[model samples]
Target chain A: MSSTRSGGRSAIVRARVLAAASDLVTTKGPQNVTIPEIAQRAGVAASSLYRRWGDVGALLLEMAAERLAQKFPLPDEGSIEGDLRCWTEKIVLGLNSTEEPIFFRILLAAGDVAPEKRIKALAPRREQLQAMLERGRARGERTPTVEDLVDHLLAPLYMRALVGLPVNEALAKHLVERLLNTPP
Target chain B: MSSTRSGGRSAIVRARVLAAASDLVTTKGPQNVTIPEIAQRAGVAASSLYRRWGDVGALLLEMAAERLAQKFPLPDEGSIEGDLRCWTEKIVLGLNSTEEPIFFRILLAAGDVAPEKRIKALAPRREQLQAMLERGRARGERTPTVEDLVDHLLAPLYMRALVGLPVNEALAKHLVERLLNTPP
Candidate 1:
């Protein structure tokens, strides 16, 4: 009973902190939101927040990962192109969201983000993408490698966002078409 | 004669500052090298650099643009694939240089980097790539649009770099292959 209560308390604190971060990022934009502000808004100790996230960038990254995955889970829509189009369109939408245009710059601005850090931040998304591709392969379809998807699909969308290009459903569909039609 | 002398003096100062910035960046890495150190090394006042580039990030961007273009001029190898492969391989090498992993993170970290600034930073290279594609069209080949090259070629390479993936000549060649073989 004691252990369960502590676990419940931990879960509440995490939810409150993430909620505070989302509110601040939506209002003030991402770069302006700081750890102290997040802590104060969450009603958690600033030290506790710092100990967990290390900095505003890491905290924002964690929030983005969780929120993006939860908000736009990729579907198994029976074809790689269909699933990819769905995923790509959702990612374009996600990038447009108030809070997710992202902390990528912040993370890199911190120090080019070590390989380990970059891997940690991307692993969740990569796993889901990989699973989607594995499903395509299991269906005996000629599936492009994850690297191809990164190069053709994800990279283009994210790079477009980074460079302030338009990211729309049509463009996302075009990227998926290119990914599928392109040869090995 | 007075104007001529001023022009000469300006050129000399510009060279000194760029050289100092490069040296400092090479020794200390891009993020760590500051305007003060660059100014001190070049024997110029910090005020002058501030007046020109506005920040370390801006200064570093100017340096990268000048150096990368100078050191790795893209060739017209008379075919889109050949030209792209040469360009891509050289870029892979360029990214491996002491200080060109780049100020992209720095610039973006400062802000999302206004589209105009991103355009200005990329304009010189874009012009060259455009010229190469026009040549491909003249030769009656099914040329990919400039946007396609950006999405398929440049975005992939830069994204891989951003993600801490290894960039090399073989991968560069592979990207060019994929870019050419893929239909619009």
Candidate 2:
């Protein structure tokens, strides 16, 4: 019972800290936000933050995963191309959004970290995409490997995002067309 | 004449620094090596290291680009599938090697400080892949967008690399087949 209570409290603290960090990221660019500031803003102790997250990268990775989950959702459009386009548009929009660029930037920054963090941060996104692909396959889309589909459809967005270049709807449409028209 | 000499000197210094850094990364893990240490090994002043490379991430990015360029000439394999398999297998071998994982980890870390650096670092590899795709297309193998083909074929290698997982030759073959079979 004591352990359960402690776990609950820890979960609550984590949520609060995540919320505060999200706001800071939105308000200031990700590079500007620091852990102590996040703790102060969240009304949590610095030691608690460190203890829960293990390090700033760990904390930022969690925050990015949470934010990305909320920002990009897989809408079941009932058609393969439609679903892909929807997903593609959502990702491109997230990358291109003026407000969320910092979040995207931070996520990419984290991805650019050491292999361990890059993989940990990427695993959640990859799994979610694979799940979406499975749904599409169930609906008879003739999708390729979940890994291939995700990489093909999303890599361009990541490429453009990291390049800090304009990615308009036209580019998104081109990517969708390429993915859809690609022969399996 | 003076301008040419200065440019040559700059290139030579850059090459030496990158070479020294690669030697260190091969011998020591990414997290264990330092910029000053790299400078000491390269026989350049520590201040020169900072002025030229800015930080370890900057140097790592250069080293990654240089090392990556060396890993592939791909081959005249006669078919896109064959070429891709061969190309990807080489990369898989590199990733599986004991030393290269740490090298990639450092490259990922560099991506954090400069997101643009990620694209720059990956540009040569992307171009080489793109060139191969173009050659395949010219040889009458139907390929979708060259960019998508490259990403689809290579992203998993990268995903696996970042994830700290082994990418076996069978997996590389599978990825290549999926990519070759997929039409954009």
Per-residue lDDT over A1-184 for candidate 2, one digit per residue giving the tens place of the 0 to 100 score: 9999999987888889989988887787666677899999999898877776666666776788766767776677787677777877877777655554554456544533555665575566667777777887898777766545545666556655543345667777876776667665
Predicted model with the maximum DockQ: 1
**Local distance difference test values of all predictions, in order:** 0.75, 0.68
Candidate 1 to native Cα RMSD, angstroms:
5.7
- Candidate 1 has what TM-score? 0.67
Candidate 1 per-residue C-alpha lDDT over A1-184 given as tens digits, one digit per residue, 9 for 90 to 100 = 9999999999999989998998887788765788899999999999999897777766776676677667667799999888987888878877777654554544444343455556576676678888999999999999998888878888888777665567789999888876777667
Quote the TM-score that chain A achieves in each candidate.
0.75, 0.79
Task: Please give the range of 10 consecutive residues that has the lowest summed lDDT in model 2 chain B.
Answer: B107-116
Candidate 1 clashing pairs, residues 3+ apart or interchain: none
